[model samples]
Target: MKIAFYGSSLVSSYWNGAATYYRGLLRDLAARGHDVTFYEPDAFDRQQHRDIEPPDWARSVVYPATEEGLARVLAEARHADAVVKASGVGVFDTELLEGVIRNGASHAIRIFWDVDAAATLDEMRGQPDHPLRATLKQLDLVFTYGGGDPVVEAYRGFGARRCVPIYNALDPATHHPVAPEPRFSADLSFLGNRLPDREARVEEFFLRPAASLPDRSFLIGGNGWQWKELPANVRHLGHVGTAEHNAFNCTPLAVLNVARDSMADIGFSPATRVFEAAGAAACLITDAWEGIELFLKPDEEVLVARDGQDVAEHLRALTPARANEIGEAALARVLAEHTYTLRGAQVDAILAEEVGQMRSVA
Candidate 1:
């Protein structure tokens, strides 16, 4: 099957958190003998800050952020067996969503692949005129990064034909244990872009804990945090590249996972960083969210933190030996169960079944 994925930049993780998820899943899909082409807009300075070149596993098309550029890519993508319009493309998303369905091949499975389902669903509910609401039922299927039953049911209520949560998973080839880098070393570290939905939680889970333990070193990675006030002990490293993720995860005594406001409330939406950190066998301390056990068992495989206090206590009590033990446990669990190899197979089966059914009906 030929798959055309319209998403944020695939070669750049700069300001684009979905880059790793796209690479891991699409690479897996390509490995399964499917032709995969990724079409991303050259917006938000992403092309200028690409972390990796166009990969051999998948064809990458970086289009200009203009209507003409979008049209050219849409013309090329119309023939794919599966055409995916991912959420948060950051440029002409509405046009792309509607365009794919309008212009794609008659038998093509038009999919709305959402990296942030919780947030998207909230928008749909709050604004009846939301662009996706108009196309919700027209899409052949909706695939989410993660949101579990709540997201599934909500999309169904909104008249989606089918909705599946293709939860985030680790690509061991991309994210695994590496020799710790001195710059990322810290008692506790967090890497996430400072966004409105996530900043409050980051402050509560990461900054507060850093303040509570002034003597302990804290590291903050990811872009847009350079201006934010941080504790004297916390070192801010803006924009950690994808190639350095393993080292970033490995160097810290513990890595923190803070969910966005919507993701935590909706539950079951684990960010890609969770898997990346765990894949590196980093002792992960994550904020409380439902369905975490489905990915990594708390206490043994991961450390669950209810609030800033919990994070502080976990950091204070964590021994190097205990951290390594938990990290190893996480690594074992993800390698065995939560990996892109498994996720890609699952999606491949879903697409095959859906496409088969559509063709039969035709």
Candidate 2:
């Protein structure tokens, strides 16, 4: 299969989370012998701030963000077996969708892969400014990064012919436990990009835990949180990337996960870090989110803590023997059910199903 992906950025993970998810999924697809041509805008300076590249497995087409460039690219869209458009790209998304929907109908399948489901829904509900609502009917298929329940209903409710959740997945080969390094050693670690909405959750679910465990060393590794004044007990390591992520996950006694407001409200949708941390065989303690148990069995594969006190309790409970067991179980569960390879297959199935339904109707 030949697939074309037009997303926020496939080349950079700098302030771009969707890129990380796409790289994992598409790279897996490429490994499966599918030809992938990832389209990225020349804007955002992604080439300079590249995180994960084409991986020598796929082709990358970086085009200008102007009208002329988009028009030229849309012309080539007809050659692809599947073409994907992701949310959060700072362009004229509605117009771009309209073009693909109308012109790319000859040979390509149009897919809208939404990384931000809640924010998209919220926008669609409010005003005409939401670019996707009108274009939803024209999209061949809809895939979400992580909304287990609400995502399906909401996308279909918005007139998506088909909707599927392509949740964040872990590749165990990339995220395995390693020898503890001094840089990553901490009693607990939380790694996430800083955002306004997520900050409060961090304070509630993360910082408070640090405050409670004065004796314990907590680490924070992510971009954008540096300006925010961290508590004395908490150590901020700024931004860490793919090479350093395993160290950050494995060295800590326990890793923390706090969902953004949208993800927390939507439920069941976990960030990429959850899978990464679990895959690293870290004793994982996530802030109570509705859908965690569906993936990681609370008290079994991992633990869930709501308040600072709960974090403290889990910190104490996770001894070497206990923590290792939890990490191993969580890793097993993620590899068994939550790899990007599985997600790619799921997407392929959905696309095939849609094609069959169309043929039957015709």
| Clashing residue pairs for model 2 | none
| lDDT for each residue of candidate 2 in 1-362, tens digit (9 for 90 to 100) | 67877777777776777766887788888887788988777776556777665678778887799988888777766778787787877775765677667667565678888898887887788876566877888788888887886889988888888788889988766778888899888888999889887989889777887888788889998787889888898988876767778888888888999888988888888888899998898889888878888888999998988776798888876787888899989999998998888887877677777677767777
User: How well does candidate 2 score on lDDT at residue 46?
Assistant: 57
| Candidate number of the best lDDT | 1
lDDT of 1 at 273: 95
For each candidate, what TM-score against the reference?
A: 0.99, 0.94
Q: What is the lDDT of candidate 2?
A: 0.81
**Candidate 1 regions off by >4 Å?**
none
Root mean square deviation (Cα) for candidate 2: 1.9
Over the full model, what C-alpha lDDT does candidate 1 score relative to the true structure?
0.94
| Model 1 agreement with the true structure over 15-99: per-residue lDDT tens digits | 8999999999999999999999999998999998999999999999999899899999999867898899999999999999988
Q: Runs in model 2 with CA error above 4 Å?
A: 360-362
